[model samples]
Structures are given as C-alpha cells and as structure tokens.
Target: MLTRFVHSGPVRLWTQHLGHPTDPTILLVMGTATQGIGWPDELMRTLADNGRHVIRFDHRDTGRSDTVDFTTHPYTLADMAADTTAVLDGHAIPAAHIAGISLGATIGQWLAVHHAARVHTLTTIAASPMGNNPGPAWTRALTGQPAAPDELPPPTARFLNHLTASAQTPRTTHQQRIDADVQTWRVLNGDTLPFDEPAARQFVEHSYTRATDLTAATNHDRAGRHWDDNRRAPLSAITAPTLVLHGSADPLFPQHTAKPWQHRSRQPD
Candidate 1:
C-alpha cells in the first residue's frame, strides 16, 4: 500500500492492492471518513478477477491522509475533485473508470462534472443528488443538523447509525459490523483523539455545507442535488459510457435514486 500526496501536500490518496499499471484502471473513491481499506475484499477481488486494474484511494482529511487544517484555505468539494485528478496525473494514468459510494459518490459526481477528461466511465453506488433528503436529517448528527445542540443524540449512537444507515448492504450479525466499526474507528482516530464525546462532536462540526461546494443543490436531497447541480451540464455532457448501480434495500438512499440516473445520464447514472 502507498499513500500519495496530491494537489500540493494537504490532500493525500491512500492507495492499496495495486496491480499492473498498464491495464485499464478502475479508480474507486470511498465515502467520507473511510480509508481505502474499507472496500469489501470480496467485491474488490471480484473486480480484479474480472480483469480490471482496480485502484482504491483515500480522500483528504480521511484515514491516514493529511488532516491538517485546510479549513483556513477555503477547501471545497472542487478541491477534493482536484485532488482526484492530481492523483491520476501523479500516477501518470491518462484515463480511468471512476466509482464511488455516498460521500465518494458525491466526489465522483464532482469528478465527472469538473474533471471530465480524467474519467473514462462513471459508477456511483449508494449516493443521492443533494440536500434536504432523509440524508440531511439522518446526517444532522454528522453535519451539525437540527441547529439545536440539545437534540443531538449520543455520539456513539450517531456514529454507529451513520455506518449502518449509509450502507445499502446488510450483515447477518449487524452488531458485529458496529463493533468492528468502533474498533477500526479507535485505531484510525487513535486513543489520543476524543474517545467518548469530543471526537463525535468534532466530526459533526465539520459537516456544514460551504458556499463553494461544487455539486448542484436544486433538489431537497442528495440525488436532486446532483441532478440539479448538473443542470447546466447534464449527464449527457459526460462523454464516457456510464453504469450506475444501486441496492434495492438500502435504507439511506433508496433504489429509486438509481432510476433517475438511468433516465438522465447519456448512458446511465
């Protein structure tokens, strides 16, 4: 595994499970606060077995990537999109098929919209258009929602719920996923970071939407946000073929979101 600095040094893409660089590359961008290691092993291996040159990377401020306070430098989603492009440029990959989920999907949308040249095809999993959906309400904990501090649920409960609610897939012993999430979180956040309360509040504080956030925000939810954001440059603007996959049982983003993508994209969302 390698951690690469891109777009100067503030943002890093933690890379993993590398293959021959010459093959057709499928760049996987994970959701918020998740490292490259979070991608399911079975699914990742399946992509490799399918003869794909699979690549996964961590976004800035997440995982081992630099968490230095870029908050002062006007960090926007466009900056994150730039980071993805920089990673591709840094690795010398001319083009790639991009895939993402949730926050990753949000970034993928920005990549497709703002850095069209670097992406060959697009695959978005478990993501919506933008603001006001259940995503916003449910994520009030993460994004500093309800505007009232008293309404906030327990931080542990919020974190646990965030993991479960964000996932379209379900586990047999669901509690195991929660336990594993907490364990991994402990390792990632480190014992020195806030364990009980501070960490959760810290995460929640950074959740607000800034004016410079690149994606469109027309709809009440994430799906509409993406769709409306892309209004000036619809999915048809995407030169590459696209394949959008959605899980039917996902609690956070319903399967219906996939339908709009299918309907709107030049190929599919």
Candidate 2:
C-alpha cells in the first residue's frame, strides 16, 4: 500500500493506493466526517487480491487533508463529487468503478447523474435519497420535526456519544481515545453483525495515529447542506449499472430508503 497526498485543483487530498496500476480501479468513498483510512484494510486487500486496484482518500476537512471552516460557503456535495474526479485525475485514471457509503453514496449518485461517463458502475451502501423522502420517524425527530404520537423519540444518548467521540480531542491519552471510539462503534454496530471489539479498537487507534480532526463530522455535514435545494437528485438520469446496498437492520437509515433508488435506477422498457 502507498500513502501520499494527491492534489485536486487547490485541494490536496491524502490518498492510499493498493494493487497494481494495470488492474481495474475501484474508488472507495467514505461517508460524512470519516477519513479514508477508516476503510478496513482487509476489505481493500480482498478486492485488490482479486485483480482490482483500490483507492481511498481523505475528504477535504478530514484526516491529513486540507481543513475547511464550515462558516464560509465552504464546500458542498457537488464539490466533493468533483473531488472524486480530481483524485482520479491525480492518479491518471480516466474512469473507474465507484463504491460509496453514507454521504459517499450521495456523492457517487451525483457523480453518476452529472458525470455519467466517468463512472463504470456505482454501488451505494447504507444511504438514501439526498434530501427529502420523509425518512423514518426517527429521522424526522432528529431533524426537529414533531414526532408522530406513535413514533418513538430519537435515541439521544447513543447518538450524542457518537458526536462526542467525533469531537474528542487528541489531547487525551491514546488509550482513552481508543476506548471512547470502541464505545461509539459498539453503539453503531448493526444487530446482524457481532461487534468486533479488538478489531474496532485497533482501527480506532490506527486512524488516530494517522490523523485526527475533531470537526470533520460537523464540517462534512455542513458541506452536505449544498443539496438542501435539490436534496433528491434524479436517479433516473444515471446511465451506469447501479446497486443499492443497505442492511435491513441499519439504524441510521432504514432499509426502506433504498427502495426509491432501486426503483428509479431501473432501465427503461
């Protein structure tokens, strides 16, 4: 694996490359606030071992990449899409298959919508239509809407811990930080998969040592507000073969959110 900085216009991105240049490329896009290194090595190597070149890079405000203050018109989802292309340009790759998770999925969908030629295939994991689909009641509650009488209140304690973890300063001892990370991941783990405490702890420690940015998640969420006007991009516009993957037990985004995308991306008769 090679780790280095790749420039996309004025933005310098921290990137990691695995596998040979001759192999087909797979660009992995991570969701809001998370650094590219957060991607598991096993997953990247598994794909690379099967003759694929895997690339993962830190977004502008995260990890070792350039930082942005969310106050100014900062960046937006569209800018992030362009960042993906810039990464490809930096690597001299004309085009490649893309797989995205959470906010990354939103970026991939927009890339396919507006830059169809640049995408060979797209896989969106654990995300929903951009802005408004009347998500679940939990989503509504989180967004400050009045919860339906029957709807359950948002899980504040659990969610707040995640925010607390993201905003944790590196000033704390490494072990304490890793322990906080473990707790956060424990809360977010899906029911279908057993939590791997040791692995999660190791990953948290590795990412901490690599880079730390307390404001990444908040800045990322701010940047994503660019889609506020047209939250839901037109999925039918995407011509590439697309796959929507969501866990049935995903707490952040319900599995049903994937249906509209699956329905919209179908080929015309």
Candidate 3:
C-alpha cells in the first residue's frame, strides 16, 4: 500500500492506494467519523487482487487528516464530495468507480448528482437516497423533524438506545475509548453475524492510536446539521450505473431503504 496526503483547498486528506495505477480505479469512501482504515486490509487486498486499483482516504477530521473547528469552518456533504474529487485530482485520475458506506454512501450520491462526470459508477451501501427524507432516527434528532410517510423507516430502537447510552458514558482513558469503539461495532454487527470481537478490537485500537484528534471527529455531526445546500437535486439526476447493497440486519438503515436505489438504476448483471 502507498500512502500520501491530498489537498482539498485548505483541508488535507490522508489517502492510501493499493494495486497498480493502470487498472480501473475504485475509490472507497467510509462512514461518518470513520477513517480509511475502516475499509479492512483484507478487503482491500481482495479488490487489488482482482486487478482493480483501490483508493481509500481519511475524511478531513478523521485519522491523520487535517481537523478543522466546524464552528469556524463548517462544510456540507457537497464540500465532502469535492474532497473526493481532490483525491482523484491529486492522483491525476479524471474519474473513478465509487463505493461508499453509510454517510460515505450519501456523499457518493452527492457526487453522482452534482459531479456526474467524475463518477464512473456508484455503489451505495447502508444508505438512503440523497434528496429523500432522512432514514436514520438520529437524523430526525439532528433536524428536529419526523420522516415523511413515503420515507424509509428509521433505525431500530435497540440501535438508537445503544447510541444514546454510549454517548452519555464518558471515556476518559484510551482503553475506555477503544472499548467503546468495539462495543459500537458489536451493536452494529447485529444478531445474525458472529461478532468478531478480536478483529474489531484490533481495528479499533489501530484507528484510535492513529487519530490526530479523535474528539474532533464529532465535527462531522456538526457539519451534517449545517448543510449549506438547501436545493438538493433528486436521486434521478444520477446518470452513472449504480449498485445498492444493504444488510438485512442493518440496525441503522433497514433493508427496505435499499429499495428506492434499486428502482432508480438498472440492476447489475
């Protein structure tokens, strides 16, 4: 793997590349408050071995990327989309296939809509449509509005309760913070899958140790509240071929949330 820093205007993002640059590029965008390393090394290797150039990056306020005070330098998802373009630009790549999870998936939709030419293809996992009403219960808490009748169902109560309890519990020590991350994954992993506590713990520890300022990652939540673009284009604006994936046991975005995306694009063969 090759690591480098890419500049997005004033912000700097830490990016890593695997596989040969000559191959088709796949840009992996991770979830909110999560870094590039959240895309496991094993998965990266598999994609690389398949003759694809894979790129992953730390979002502006996560991992080794530059952290900004959201109060002074607030940014929207549109801005985050621009950051992805910067990563491509830094590598002299004109376009790439985008695979994003959770909040990353939302940003992928934004790129597909506004910067259509830059997106070769889009893969959205565990995400609701971009311009649609919010799908997560936490988003309702953030916006102080209820989901419309046509919108996807909110997250499960069990998951919301876990988030609440986790937020309220203070983690003053490094080990406490690491444990908190492990527990968060346990809840997110759901009941069907065996929770790999050892692997989760190792990833969490690595992320925690590499972070520039873990607390600063909360800036993403703050940024979400202050999205500057009010007139968002509909998901229909996406011209790229799309793939949508959602786990049946996803606690945050229920399986039904994937329906709209499937209906919007032709099914992948």
Query: Which candidate ranks first by lDDT, i.e. highest?
Result: 3
Q: How far is candidate 3 from the true structure (C-alpha RMSD, Å)?
A: 4.1
Model with the higher TM-score, candidate 1 or 3: 3
lDDT of model number 2: 0.76
Q: Taking the tens digit of each residue's C-alpha lDDT, what string does model 3 give over 1-269? A: 99989999999999999999999999999988998999989899999999999999999999999999887778878788889999999988899999999889989988888888999999999876665445354577445567554456677777877878998877988788888889999999988889999999998888888999988888877666544343256677789999999898888776554555554332112
lDDT for 51 (candidate 2): 99
Each model's backbone clash number: 12, 1, 0
The residue pairs that clash in candidate 2, if any, are 131-231
Lowest summed lDDT across 10 adjacent residues in model 3 is found at 260-269
How does each model score on TM-score? 0.58, 0.81, 0.89
Give the candidate number with the greatest TM-score: 3
Local distance difference test, candidate 1: 0.55
Q: Tens-digit lDDT track for model 1 on 7-121?
A: 5355545555455667788888877555555575566778877777777765665554555344354455556667677678777888798888776776776677667888888
Please list the residue runs of candidate 1 whose C-alpha ends up more than 4 Å from where it truly belongs after superposition: 1-9, 130-233, 255-269
Q: State the lDDT of candidate 2 residue by residue for 1-269, as single tens digits.
A: 99867887777898899999889999999988788977888989999999999999998887888876667648788888888999998898888999999889988888888888889999999777654333365566655676554333344445644655567646377677677768777877855789998988877777676665755656877676554543465677789999999876775654433345444332222
> What is the Cα-based lDDT of residue 155 in candidate 1?
34
lDDT of each: 0.55, 0.76, 0.84
How high is the lDDT of residue 235 in model 3?
72
C-alpha lDDT of residue 185 in model 1:
46
User: For model 2, where is the 10-residue window of minimal lDDT?
Assistant: 260-269
